[model samples]
Target chain A: MAEKKMGLHTIKLKNPPSILSTATIVGPKEGEGPLKDYFDIVLEDDLFGEKSWEKAESKMLREAVRLAMNKINLSPDQVDYFFAGDLLNQIISSSFAARELGIPFFGLYGACSTLTEAMSLAAMMVDGGFADITIAATSSHFSSAERQFRFPLEHGNQRPPTSQWTVTGAGAVVLGREGKGPYVTYITTGRVVDFGIKDANNMGAAMAPAAADTILRHLKDTGFTAADYDLIMTGDLAKIGREIAADIIKQNGYDITTKFTDAGIEIFDLTTQDVHSGGSGCGCSASVFGGYIYKQLINGNLNRIMIISTGALLSPTSTQQGESIPGIAHAITIERSLEK
Target chain B: MEKRKENEIKNIYQQMVQKKVPQSSLIKDAIFAFVVGGLICDVGQFFMNLFLSFGISKDDVGYYVATVMVFLGAFLTGLGVYDNIGKYAGAGSIVPITGFANSIVSPAMEYKREGYIFGVGSKMFVIAGPILVYGISSSIIVGIIYYLVKVLAR
Candidate 1:
């Protein structure tokens, strides 16, 4: 008989990886969010005393990684691999940080979804016994992303209401085979889904469908319903994308409206922040997960939670060529350690 | 068969995505543009009057006014005040000669670190290149047409 798999896309790890420690660093805007208290450091200046935004982002990521390691009483040399990514072209932020950290590095490119993508890979490495300890991290800066993806900041183009603000922050999580924390139980890798969304400004709409698809597939594969998990979080969907995702999932017979929340929406006080559609970036979900979600799990306030980090795979060249944005969402299920 | 399944999925996804497209307020944007644009024009007219008062010839006043406006626009862009105005005024800041000055200087300022030839020089005309090309080409075409008409009439 063939070994049974968990649905079509899910993987049930034989050795569950535990989240040893996590750290988050955010900009002034993100620091003003509801979960501000949970983050490790909140910089008053987005530049973090750096000359350029790109360098600032790299510095933030390095600091987050160091903080996470410090919390676990481990140094950079002790960590097996550093899995990191960012929204910048060629992921220079992560690459430059990796060079500084001097660890076995695996740079990822998942746009806004990079957090969960890195975590999923890190979990797999720990579970598969490939490595004992690994760090998963990602960062995004508003100034850097704005110039790279859209017009220059000085252009003063009126941002449409559909546009989501990129969170200027970084989050890092350390995963290991043994730890007194939440266990990464399962992972569901997603497929790139394109809905023919041509507007580059409205990233939430482009990535929402992928979030819904991954959520539905994850539920099916894991043989779990909406009620089974305390929370079902989608990364960077913000306000507009969250509603669209909820509707799509409901149409497929999964009504997770009450339990569903989004990192983008949760990161900011929408009314006070004036962040039109809310926050959307690799760091949006990463910081929220590392700071808020992990804390809740460790405190026993929540049990099982599934995070589906959504990414829009579009380059400047691709958008200029009039190609529709393709989105992907990677899901990871984390549960409070029963032994603890 | 595979292609058909993919298309079906694509159609459903597209329908769902279309529902979430945020609506833009046409009236508010128009009001901003109108007020901003009008104010910029008023500034230009003020400059024209100022030049005429200084005893500049009527024919030369237009050139001097344009020079002043362009210089002001570039200067404001460098000082970072123009961006704030742009934020509030929307098209008001962009639809005028100041906007043109902003377009060129902003990119040049941004790419200055990459060195003169590759960074600033190459990217300097990114936003204004097309406008220059079309503007010059159309003027030449109009000149040729006018010459042909004059010759034919004679």
Candidate 2:
């Protein structure tokens, strides 16, 4: 007989407010809809130049961290540790910012699922007695990323409708000792899953199956149905990936029709931004979660939310190998506790 | 006197290095670098789009884009754009074909003096040859698979 490998853990957020504030950073303007109050930070001020690339990223990251700290009224020194990273090289933008903040920091890189990875790690630290308060953050800049990942702005490459836009911004969150709000109760890390896809433009299609695998595993491990939580969130698996994830979940007979949502999908609803399915990058969730969702949490608009941040674990070497994309996802549960 | 002379020389070298690249605020410098780099690309893209709108065919877009990209890549590689973008975007530049173009041409250009046959010719295909092979092979395989699927469905 095969023993069950899935494990489950739970935590209750104290003084769980109904609504949490959420913020979104985009090219030059602040984002609207379900995000205004959740976060008050904007990248428009620091965003400059024909493409400030590294300068833009480092600036946005600092602003995002500053915003999250401000919203929660916590200083950098008071925070136990700063957890952050990005899709950039050596995750320098994150490390560099953390250095300046002078907070004890732990850097991480999870491609797109960075927000969830940071959240899960911060949750563990808070729950494990390692620290009482920790901040999780992530960022990606479009100009900087495009020049780095694809063509320079001058290359004039056209994007297909299936392609997802990487947003330019950063997001941060301060997770304190359980009594302040809903704390992360459980987390499930996903293995790298691939479907032999090589089209770099269509990431959602490549990442959907990975999302499904993890969601199913999370439900199995927790012995809970989709209806157990108010929302089920996937990080950055844009439109195509969301459809694939939904199909996979439905195929498994654990339907999440009413509740399933994606950070990448929702954030890109503003067409003026030209992002087909919304924004991607670790900052998609970090800023949205810290800015928009946190506001709703504090306002008592939403009580329990399960955030499943998703990541794609593809490197330049692997992509160049003609190998398919291997995606990884992580799920962290946040909800209100009775005692607080 | 000998030790003092060596020390003075070292001090002059340090001063020269500092003058070449001043140490500013890390966060400010990084942010400035990222934003400026991004804007330059934006301008380049705008011009590319304008050029494409002038009736330059799609397939040839690569040719046009390549000229600009090669120049930019060369400059960046020269001014250290590749390394900076690498720090910021990770696999950002290299993931694109332009990156492939840079990877092939830059090293070849640098080592052309080593003999065109051993250096330029050999190294030219080092980064991109396999991609072309895979691209062609996959198309064939995919075509076969499609045919099978269509026949089976019928």
Candidate 3:
């Protein structure tokens, strides 16, 4: 009744929330990647002097959140809500980081799709007149994810070709009621889609269907073709998933092949990086969008972008129990505010 | 009727995924495994010869050779060299006694953060524990069969 809903699954905000500031931090491996200069902080070591990988991941999330707020001279008390998530069990990284910030927290677990989950929800809160300023943050450390999801650090096991390297990083975005430019205009909440994919190594394959479903629905709702947006970025779809998603989207009558780009494929050089397929995890999309794409928007290098972050919701126990992975994707349209 | 259509789509999607995924060559992997695994065994044989030459009894040489190989595996794992070797060698590295050593030592090194007692001591056998349990139990069964056969012969 308040705002005109675009169709099923699409939210058209009456008042758009502005992206006030963004900060990104990554480990040495990601810093060595192509988007090295974009990140605010490049950790020389993965551990960052923590005794355990979990602690290190928590520290990175905290630092990125603080840096985002500090850039605009806003304190933790100023931010009305905190939306944070990570790949760790119980999302310990976000929970621990949230403890230190003393902000009201909404702990999320959308797997690799946490960034958009945080962003879209934060935008909703800001547009609804509930809060003035909000922060959306997520983190994923390679070692932490490995121990929690795969194997111990020293465990000698070969990664399958389908496997992706989790980006060791964290990203934070501070959103406000009014700002200069780069406003969160629309959110397309994803529905859970499962092709009953069982192989966790092929996460890109598992999530590709959801990525296609969300993008197709968003386009159908908004009545906009793929040509309308400058870029349509999917989070951590990597090589195989990106291809499969593109194929599926085209089959559904919306051809986004030209405009489509995946944060997973963009974050690392596939041939040389030894990241078999490409970079993945929540931080893959988070670090890419929060650091690189945000800068491009500010510089007017890009006009409009639809970021559809995908998640393959499979826990270690579920995978062991032969439960199929259910994939989800959430999308947000961030546009450059029209200049006067 | 709706469920059947969903099943059809899922089947089509699965096939597409299989095509897109890069296939690993089994023959190529096997070659690497044969070479690297053979080298590890050669080193074990060398140790056996070395221990025998050192005036250690033939009976004691097997024990000494095993200790040396296990020590080497643990040392390389600690230095973070074995993981790299294991990557290329695949089962070549994993099929040997050194692999057994790696199975035990790797988890111990990783879990050291949780502390020596609960972390290292308990998790040390996590990978190799099932093997030891089954291996010993099977041997007891085999030993009892031999005892019965000897008694029957008498």
Chain A TM-score by candidate, in order:
0.98, 0.88, 0.98
Tens-place lDDT digits, model 2, residues A63-147: 6777667765667778887788898889988987887899998999888888888877777677667787787888888766765
TM-score of each: 0.95, 0.65, 0.96
Q: Which window of 10 residues has the lowest lDDT sum in candidate 2 chain B? A: B15-24
Please give the distance, in angstroms, between residue A208's alpha carbon in candidate 3 and its true position after superposition.
0.6
DockQ list for all candidates:
0.60, 0.02, 0.74
DockQ top scorer: 3
Error of 1 at B148 (Å): 2.6
Q: Residues A1-340, candidate 1: write the lDDT tens digits.
A: 2242488888887788899999999999999989999999999999899978899999999999999999979988889999999999899999999999998999999999899999999999998889999999999999899878876666656778888999999999999999876999889998998888888878888888899999999888877899988999999988988998899899999999999999999999998987889999999999999999999999999999999999999999999999999999999999997553
Off by over 4 Å in 2: A1-26, A29-38, A45-51, A270-272, B1-154
List interface RMSDs for the candidates, in order. 1.9, 20.8, 1.1
Q: What is the lDDT of residue A289 in candidate 2?
A: 71
Candidate 1 fraction of reference contacts recovered: 0.59
Mark the 10 consecutive residues where model 1 chain B has the least summed lDDT. B13-22
Count clashing pairs, candidate 2.
69
Candidate 3: which stretches are off by over 4 Å? Answer: A338-340, B141-154
- Lowest summed lDDT over 10 consecutive residues: which window, candidate 2 chain A? A13-22
lDDT agreement with native, every candidate: 0.90, 0.67, 0.92
